[model samples]
Target chain A: MKQDSCQVTVIDRKRIELARKQMPGAEVLENVSEVLKLLGDTTRLRILLALATTELCVCDLAALLEMTSSAISHQLRLLRARGIVKYRKEGKIVYYSLDDPQVQSLIKVSMDQIG
Target chain B: MKQDSCQVTVIDRKRIELARKQMPGAEVLENVSEVLKLLGDTTRLRILLALATTELCVCDLAALLEMTSSAISHQLRLLRARGIVKYRKEGKIVYYSLDDPQVQSLIKVSMDQIG
Candidate 1:
């Protein structure tokens, strides 16, 4: 029996050429990374998770995370800027929630994959 | 009618206090990030997608992507390190495939979310 070890690595020129033409470009990857990186953190992930399950005001998130409302506000600011979450102002009381359905789906999938 | 802007923001001490006890910690978020980051890249995501559909050797991937086998190997190395993908040997020919079902699920969710 002969193993491929001694043989030269095979090059599927046609396939490789076709893929180079078909694969996505830098812009798409960069965009995807931005979204994932936002979800990559402990605080943000928790914030997003909490929001996904239910809309909450800053005080609510602060209470849940045991963090300062100031701290929670800072993270929420980032999430809002990226369009990952959205807020509705009802007077001084602003409630936040996941802005995109994809965000919720992505998080659910993330949980399933890790589990 | 007075908007809450001029008023002191209300803090739901009871709700906030309760939530702090329920949320997750740093460890879980960090672990989830690891998986998401691997899929964050364009090339790696592409590789994972290819493998998810069909197992292929390095050369097959290289051919399909129109990349040098060396470039493909480098990406595969990163994916393997993260446990995102795996490979088997047939002589010198090593074939690769995704190691977990979660990877596929995550990608699908990502696509749906982004789409």
Candidate 2:
């Protein structure tokens, strides 16, 4: 395919360099990638959106999104492993919520932009 | 597998609800998911970071990242299709850069948090 030539004004070039310089550490890239990967999936995104509204157990999440509990469990496991979500035990039930405030804020900002 | 119980404090509940409400449009979710999915890959993420610093054509991007031109081309195609990156043609070379300021800002903020 024919590619178009792009021009980089001095200002944008400086901005890009600043962005790269400001990027977090190697470990942070991994974590951010993990978080982004988790958010990449539609099912997972919806699950997160639902959870963003309320702390729900696997079953409740499944019910709200009309997905299977097994699927929700699998996605939740991914999110939990990435530290994007945390869970607590109440008897035999497991309720889950955002692991960090940053996660909520990131989602909020993205939502605000898109909304 | 046994799941852990999670507790939802009122504050968190309110925050989550607010996040859900604030999330952009269904279209933005699709777009965000597209962008995130593109960034989810290590190769693509590295490419974006590199491009985030400078406007580079396929050749420069491939050379800087030490990847094949073919690979860079493919990834750039995805970025361009999603409006994450735009390119202009100058002779036989095509230069690519970020399509929107939001992308740069988002990357910067994420890097800041993790850094």
Q: Which one is best on TM-score?
A: 2
DockQ of each: 0.30, 0.20
Give candidate 2's error at residue A53 in angstroms: 1.6
> Which candidate tops DockQ?
1
lDDT of 1 by residue, A41-89 (tens): 7788888888766778987776666677788899999999989899999
DockQ class, candidate 2: incorrect
Instruction: Write one digit per residue (lDDT tens) for candidate 2, span A1-115.
Output: 2222433112233444555564445676787777767777777787777777777776666555556678789988888887888999888778888877787677666555533
lDDT by residue (tens digit), candidate 1, B1-115: 2113323244655554455555555676678877777776666777876676677888777655556778889999988987878899999889898887777777777765673
lDDT of 2 at B40: 72
- List the global CA lDDT of all models: 0.72, 0.67
TM-score of each: 0.70, 0.76
Model no. 1, DockQ: 0.30
